[model samples]
Target: MSLKVLSALDVARIQLYHFKAIIIAGMGLFTDAYDLFCIPPIIKLIGRIYYVEEKQYRTTPTVVVSALVAIALLGTVVGQLVFGRLGDRIGRRSVYGLSLGIMVLSSIACGFSICRTRNCVLVSLGFFRFLLGVGIGGDYPLSATIMSEFANKKTRGAFIAAVFSMQGFGILVSSVVTMVVCKIFEATSHVSNGQIPEQVDIAWRLILMVGAIPAAMTYYWRMMMPETARYTALVEQNVLQAAMDMEKVLDIPMSQIAEDSLLPSYPPPSYPLLSKRFFRRHGYDLFSCAASWFLVDVVFYSSNLFQSQTYHRFIKDQPDVNAYELAFRVARFQAILAICSTIPGYWVTVYFIDRIGRVKIQMIGFFFMAMVYFAIGIPYKYFWSEKIGIGFITLYALTFFFCNFGPNTTTFIVPAELFPARFRSTCHGISGAVGKVGAIIGTVGFLWASRIPNNNGKPDPVRMTVALVFLGVVCLVGLAVTYFFTRETMGRSLEDNENDDE
Candidate 1:
């Protein structure tokens, strides 16, 4: 088999295998999003169960809240760097199932977060969450690289975007599941005077445990997938294996296979990531991807992972609500927001990503998010006020819509499409890891920043002004970066994306 044949197959029209690859890869993302986002509600339960008596359930100390939110991000940074490089060294199919397995086990363990002491419970939950993050992080580079390698050039962006769009569904499902579970516990448990019962703990545990289901379900199919043909041929230099595998995937007859003699004889490129050849050719591309993803996530994760906190701003004056009530209300509202805005935005991207071009959609999405978020920030006090709280919720929902439609989806799509096969997973991992770093900063920093004090030492009305303004600026910077550094990958062959000779 030859490089040209593989490239031709890559750009060929879509096939059944493309959808298979999407389902196989997309399920992992669904599990990833469900596991990652589900943590917030569970953390709310943790606050209610463990900290409510301290009069700080809803107002858990910033440090404690930050730890719960940021630990998984730390693990993901490590996982992306580790699994990504390992995928290149070994093979994608070989190590692919490991991440899902980890996610399953860790998610279950996270549900059993109980311990002999309160301190032990925190340690146990945090440790499992971190491990879960590692698994979810591994899926990022692997899923993107696999889907990009499998997709046809004509619709590669849409395919990969569709895979990522499962994230929107996953998030929506998490909200729905949380709502149903909360309602079930409420209906079944013996509640006196509206006090939350011990059965409430079971609800949180069940919610956390459910994340393992989808991941475990997909593990078999994931392992059954052959190594992506690009990795087999380009990185491993096993043209025969690559040809046979792709033959099955594309249903190409043996008669169509290229002869080994005609294949390129040059050795696979093996430069270190920091080598001059790599730096000169792909350095700017690498930095742009990492920085843009980082900037988008800073706002993205903060808004998403801490969404209940944002919702609290609208209904904070509700008097005498217990922690479980607050948790249920937050999950219900989050579900509504996701159904109405988040899921729609993701589907719109899936519909138009290939048509509009990646660069244009991203820039437009960022611009709209920046403007809306800025508008929300400028009148922070007014929106937080009871008279205009609905107005604030409307504006807040728009940011989520644009985020899914724009940088959030585009950032994930581009890294998989823009880099060489050998370094594709590694580069994507680095970009993803950097994005998680920003997520950590966003989540932890926003927790503290949103609590800025006024002259009287009470929290100020303009507290969100600084954070939203910073996010809006970051989106603008993302727009500029996308314009200058990222090329549109609407119809380009993955091989064409490489800067080096075959």
Candidate 2:
């Protein structure tokens, strides 16, 4: 049990438990993505249901749309900071199930957000969405830290990225589920004179409620998971418990070393978090992770939450289509984009992350994202024109492709690996929280920036051009920060990365 001796968990080959960790941690992200992305397709439906004026439903106000989408992001910021520190202080396994519980309850509450007035409904829905966001936020750091701790160094990047890649499937499933629900309602509901049927309300509710299912299903498994060995040994100074946990999970026989015998070998107490000594060690690493995540999310969440608005112009002005049909079309388009670009980008990152290294992959992702954004922005009007609209869509999808393959995956993985065990979860939480703040900016800023004053709620091409250009600049900044400040974490044990021997 000497500190220099390789732990059984570190040397362990790929096994069933590693995959189990991925599934358990990954499912939380899947639920997070499904709940967050599902709202875009249904936002119009919510407006139609609650925002009726003069006995006819109209588009929901821009302000309301922003609130509905951004509230959860705001809550996510709170959750990440809170649960992240808690993970370090209380233990990763202790409060893990609590976050999922919040998600389940809040999702169900959001679905049943029925009230006497539109204001009441909005209040209720927004409140629950914020709570759900908190739960989703908690998943970010905990899942990454747990997976990184459990994985062997040889494939750590892939394992951590695998947990994050579930987000792609979550987004894809949201679109697919939305499409199926819209189709079901379209087929069964009566559509007299092509008016949106009342049953459409039920469809939106069903979509919101479905997010609860996956989260609830995984809660038992999350609770059953053991505290990561790194936290037990390094932070808690309980080598005996750490060895036992590793032995159980790795299914290997661990030497029964006395706790006190190994205590002297543990790394001496390090600088306190955010102290001068701590900053000297990790300040630049932290800044890079936080800034990169923030910038990526600014573009990422904006595109995701409002892509329907931007792409709605290309749906071939079907003036006669009913609301159900419109919903189905939007969901179908999103699904195609997810399958073609988003999901593939994620799995590709999973395959190559360990081979190419974290810093390089992130830089590649940011560099290309900047180029694509500028390409689309500089010729914004041309891309949106009738003859070349497909080109615009193609370029838009590519942004997502590179994003998943690049910063989106790397940002999550590196934070977990770059810091000491004591501060790993907290640092990841801070990085993710900063990213959520950027998400808030993107969701609110893009919606308002792209809205045309008198274009009946349509996105303005000129304003969208400006937004895209701004995002391109942000990506360039991310690339610069990553290249100069981010350290490579590939092929290194977590202990090695932190220089524990020092």
Candidate 3:
């Protein structure tokens, strides 16, 4: 038999048929990015509305912030198992629609929350974040499967990943939105007794409301896209009803199928996850996937979340700036570079995903990021930039670009590729959940590091260097893991799994 390998141009043409799926799938992603970007601004709002004397407050404790973010991740962990299992049993079509609905309802609910007490806010915040996580988690399986299953074999890696690269759009749009809303609030902000509570309702709540729109719009699309042919084929074997159901999904006649297309009927609605020999074969791959995701989360979230500090470390010494202005500048500047990093990185990934191969591009990105990380940390620690502070800022910005284009993107896409259909959602969720575990560690570590000031009464360069160096090491470790375990998936289709028995 001859081997089949697809080149880059072939990926572009094949992905065109399912372009609608790519657009709709990005809806949940936009919301995920929206929620993440909205948080820091909201954190600023919450601080102002509920400020204490400097002695009484320690900046929304990292533990608190981590819990809020991780809670959403926690929701995703549970969601993947529930919806993933359900998606397998009930069919991907209905479950995909239902997950988006949950996200919409929960996000709208969050818009109305009263964040008066810290606990009340944390609890309510956790609740909505969890709801959002569940929906985002649910999307992983459906989107990954759709992109992988439909694309022509030649460009499977690039095509499926390009679909996922829309996440950069989600994240990019969110950062921009936050900056816009912040400007709006600042312009219209009414301050009473040195506080900005009135502005919170208009700015932050409005941002939360933004999350609901994408879900509502995409509900219609998910209703229309053609279901996977593999799924239709999976059901055709048993009763005539199964094939009939697929006929409705594919809009194709049952008589047209090569009789061999159908799978034999199973005993019932489902089987134990472990019962299939397929699951047993997948054990090591699944473990690698989980490990890869966990490491990716650690490096990505840690690096991304701490960008607020890169601004501080770069400009902490300017003598003339007032505290509030410095704070605004910090938030604003980070938002801009982050957007720079986010938008182009996404577009580039979409452009090169097929050409470079997912694993190769990710490794390249991490390699570049590690270099930038050490460059910034080591230089700043030993030789701080006084004249051109922007030089250090430039290094930080480069890191963000790589983060958007590299491991961050790859980690999200890989699990989607590596798993079989039945366990894809579950494993993706597990992998994602594991990644959140890294987020928690990174968040907590940075929070603590921020508290450790040097003898000069500034954030210790040694401490910042240590944190970034540690992150670079984690990225290197992730690189080794990918090299050993992941097969190059550049020209493979998701349906390749159907031939496992061979």
Candidate 4:
């Protein structure tokens, strides 16, 4: 009976409800990207506001910057483990709205973080952002699993990719928002002797607050979404309700689904995650997904979070620019990069993911990522020159392109498809949690490794070259894992992917 009910979902035609599911789930990811990526452009502004030294604004202490950025990532690891398990234990719908609720509240709180002392303000912002990260973390497994379970097998990859693609838009929008806010402030405020204007403080707060809008808008729709037919039938053992839910969503007759629920029921497999049978079947796939996600994020987040520092290295030295001007320049560059490379890469994946299969796309993406990183790193000084900076930026943009088109999309897609319904959310959560660990490594490790105080607080040429080489090596490792460990899940049903029906 469970197989029959699931088959109905697997073979169903793409419909309006499918698109609805994509938007409802996709918006959470949009908010996730906005909240996560938006901070990099504003970190300097925050430092200027609070971390003043001898009446001169100092570069935010490396430790303080890492904590500000990495605290949320740390919270993400915890959220993924806890909320991921809860998603499987409770119904997806029951806890779905709760995560969004946390996001809405926390985003607002982060913007309003104000205290008497610098430490108090920093701690308050970090605390709220941690809660924001928790909410963002919950969305990963929940959104990916829900979209995978709701989609037809033929377009499952595309559907899930579509949901993930919202991330690109979120990133682009954050850049745009930061750029626009900076431009607004730049016109009204003036800097003298390099001191930041008071209005700069308000700008960062507004930018943080804006992330709440989309998440808040989608909360009602997310609450209205029904539990996936697979979870309802396979996990909840509720064939009749599953059938009824499908009948409504698929706009099919009750007659079509009613016949399946009446069929004889069979018990589902009850192996725990630790059993040898479980390891024998899924251990390598989990390793591949986790490792690939881990590796990709280490490179991706390091580059993404500190892109401003990277840009400053290549641009002509401007002796007269203020903090707002510096931020505007960085945000503008990032927005352009997103438009030219990042956003397009995601849509291209959406277009080809179902057609080419996930494994090929991932391997191809990892391969090109390595090639591009090497291209930039090998002739480090040649590309670093101000005259040829465009060449370096082009190569840098390609990494973002291939990442979104490659492992970034597939890692999220494959984990949801590779596991059984009972463990789908849990496994994907573990995978995503591991990925966040990689993000923390990237954010903290690369920030420390790349910054050299001896180089007037700029990234040292040798260290930057080494960092690029390391990322390239990580990509090569990802490519090997994709080839050896992951399986293709293009046209297979979830049960078929896991051999669950047998």
Candidate 5:
């Protein structure tokens, strides 16, 4: 009958709780990024162990190798949808720890990817990684929704972006870890030529198993987190409990918030996403988030995950070299680029997201990404040339910077803020799921397209060029949608956005 009152959390000054929430939530993403990107290098290592060793000169088929890499995205897609809905229905904290536990167990299993044959080993690895993906996917909606709900409106964008920025560190760490492990193997293995043979199989396993340590470390902390006050108050309609939870989280006195007579009563919502009421309000928001995320991921995952393959393709025709040498080169390039460009771009978003607005950053990021991709595509031969390859590499690195500074960061931030508290996790999950689908498309499609045969049945640079151009077009389209349809949520309370839906 009356307006609902804001709690200490909704309008509270930025404080310690916000940073703790960011670190806890961000750590999940850090683990997610590490697990997801770690697979790419291992994919190369596996190929060397099986295909190249057996055939003496041949690599694995593109489709087979792509499946090994992209299967986790499929798992993540299903995980986001399932866990996201469960978080909304049951509660965020109830389902949150379970996801991390799944990740811990699955990461350990992924390390033990052994079987009687190469095909069997690949299958086992894919299966365990899919299970690991299920955990990583759940973290997306849970972490974003948790951070958004826990944060004050004034710094909410930067807080959420800060959590997502952990992804850059995850990626950087994965690369550094891979390089370190490779170097260690080279030192320890008795090979005189500095080649790490099957002895380095231990490296991939160690890398994957190490991912479990971080997830395990965070389990107690995630479980200790109180359910978000927003969900408790809005969806559960328990203002007293919500107030009590906020009091604990914010260290505020409860006597001030205990008066229930002033709080408005909310009937439970029954708005299905397809219903007219829901469609009229959030349909465009959902469409925009899902579509823009979809486009960004296709390029992001394809480029990041298969970076090694891109390098390998350039040298495919050169004189034969040991696979370990090739893997080292790929890891070194990826690590340097991630450290220099990718990680910084993410923090740039964190530093300015609340200040510049999310949609604007996304637009600028998409525009520059398109320009960079096109720059590489049109001069494909020139950039690929030994004389100017460094320039091309620089441009390629810029795409990573733009991706972090652009749609990749904003898409994750906006969905968590745009939806009603009742459906926040669900909508974020939907958008994240769509993005993973884009990742699958990018990974599979790019791998297939890059290998399309010419009249001579060799790797076609022209086809690869077309793929790069397509990435540029996708970014332009996303940029348009973002500029036209995406609403900015800067400096606004979550309740403000929720009230708009009513």
Candidate 6:
């Protein structure tokens, strides 16, 4: 029978299975958001809890606090690069399980927070934070690949972007849980007025414990999910199974699957990627992805960390808030706004990813981000210019709105799609790891910039210049990367990429 002859009923089954995969991938993305965000409120809580024992916990210097954050983001950098490659080599499903396991274990360990007589507390918290970051790094490429593979060409961008949109959901949930936990810890905290209390009090331990919520959710997927059919087919050469999986997704026929999947007796198309013709092509796909992802991540993290300070100032100044009330409100507001951004972002990526293509959206978003971020530096240089300051901040938020709708959504989606099967997971992982470098750069750099105040008690021009330059460079590079490099991979069959490998 011809490809056109498949029953409509068969196509429906295939669609249902693919839908399930996207949701499952979304769950993993949630963990990434939760792991990154769970730290901020705890930073506040820990400060209050151990103020008197400041030396004991090394809470004495702002630098020390900043150091902890840097280490964790750095951990994500390591995880993305390292674990990502591991996933490609071993198998996507196994790595997915392993990454989730590490995340769950580290989160629970963080709840046992400490760092007193010995290095136990610091060691424990830092170790777990790092491990969780790594898990997030690995998950980035893995989940994106899974969603894209299972998605229909018509809706691939939307489905994957929606999976990523769950990142915002994770942020919103972490904020809510932290808020609730902070309030409860406050009421029973045995301390009042946002003070840490003279005793080894309730703040940090309570704050860290909320991480368990995501840990709990990890078990939800233990039964319902499997490896992406595309990954299974491409890397493992399990054509029959791959075809079966696709049939479930596209609702096609068994005979149609067999006919469609027939391997050419002789190889046809080619990806210069795997050709021995290229120097060190064996790992180039993996490393190049890592490098590009790492570069993009730094910009993303820098903008997010810097922008968050809009509210961070309030937390720093308001010491009298109820512990729970304080954490909850900040998270709620941030999450709410971010979630609002995701709704539109999800719609755009899903609707236009195929139509407009990835490069165009990424170029436009990064360009706009460069202009807006530079504007932020202007008011920082002139501290008294509150009107311009507010305007810059608003523009920055608008940039994020555009950021998510555009580059933020596409970059993650594109890398997973670009590479062939054997290298796809590893390549994406490498890309993820590279992204982590960006995150580390952003985390460390912005943590310092957040403190940049001018001689007039306003933001220093030097600091603003540095921030403007940093973001400017990121957007500029992104523009170049998308323009001179990168290709479209929206509608091709995975089967086609495989035959090229031969």
Per candidate, the number of residue pairs that clash is 0, 0, 3, 0, 0, 25
Order the numbered candidates by TM-score, best leading.
2, 4, 1, 5, 3, 6
Tens digit of lDDT per residue, candidate 4, span 144-207?
9999999989999999999999998898888888888888888778656376677888888899
Which runs of model 3 end up more than 4 angstroms from their true locations?
A: 1-17, 54-59, 189-197, 235-280, 313-331, 384-388, 454-458, 497-499
- RMSD, one per candidate, in order: 2.4, 2.2, 4.7, 2.2, 2.6, 4.4
Q: What does candidate 3's lDDT look like per residue over 1-502, in tens digits? A: 1111111112335423456667787677767766766676566555544444652422455556666777777777677667766666666776888888888888887776756565786678678778888887787667766666555666665666667666666655665666676666655653333443455555666767786887789898787765554454443223344445434544345664334433343322244555556566666666666777777677667766675555555444242332233335545665676566766777677778778887787787778888887776666677753333777767767876777677777777777666655666566666776776777677777766666667765566777778878877877887788788765566565535322332
Displacement of residue 212 (Cα, Å) in model 6 is 4.2
lDDT tens digits, residues 1-502, model 5? 3213354665778878888888888877998888877766676666666765534544557777678668888999999999999989999999999999998999999889876368788899889989988999999999999999988788889999999999988887887788787777766675544243677677778878887887798889999999987788778887778777877877667876565573546565676755888878888899999999999999997777446545654444232555555556666666787798999999999899988999999999999999998988776644552233567778888999999999999999999999888889999999999999999999887777656656654446677778888899999999999988898899887766754345
For each candidate in turn, the TM-score is 0.93, 0.95, 0.83, 0.94, 0.93, 0.83
* Cα lDDT computed for each candidate against the true fold: 0.79, 0.83, 0.64, 0.83, 0.81, 0.61
- After superposing candidate 2 on the true structure, give the runs of residues whose Cα lies further than 4 Å from its correct spot: 1-6, 256-260, 267-270, 316-319, 382-388, 453-457, 499-502
lDDT: worst 10-residue window of model 2: 1-10
Candidate 3's clash total is 3
Better of 2 and 3 by TM-score: 2
Error of 6 at 24 (Å): 1.2
**Can you write out model 2's per-residue Cα lDDT over 1-502, one digit (the tens) per residue?**
3442235566678999999889889987998889877887787676666666775656677777788879999999999999999999899999899888888989999998866367887899899999988988888899999999988888999999999999888888898899898888888886743376778778888999997888788889899898887888888877777777776767666653234366635564657889988887888888988999999999898778657665567554243567777777777787889899999999999999999999999999999999999998888755553334677788889999999999999999999998888899999999999999999999888877655653554567678778888889999999999989899989888887874333
Model 6 TM-score relative to the real fold = 0.83
Ranking by lDDT: 2, 4, 5, 1, 3, 6
Off by over 4 Å in 1: 1-4, 54-59, 114-116, 260-266, 313-324, 382-388, 452-459
Question: On residues 282-329, what C-alpha lDDT tens digit does candidate 1 reach at each position?
Answer: 888899889989989898987774465566665442325654566677
Higher-ranked by TM-score: 1 or 5: 1
lDDT score of residue 168 within candidate 2: 85
User: Model 6: per-residue lDDT, tens digit, 1-502?
Assistant: 2122112222233356566666667776777777567665565555544443532322223455556666777776677667667766677777777776777777766767555532466567777777777766667777877776666555666677777877777777777777666666656656655554433334456555565565456556734466555555545656556666555546566775564545422232244534564324334434434554565667777766654456654444355654455555666656655666645655566677777877777777778777776666544545513444445546766667667766777778876666655556656666666666677677777767756555644444576567766777777777777776566556554433222342
Tell me how far the alpha carbon of residue 223 in candidate 2 is from the true structure, in angstroms, after superposition: 1.1
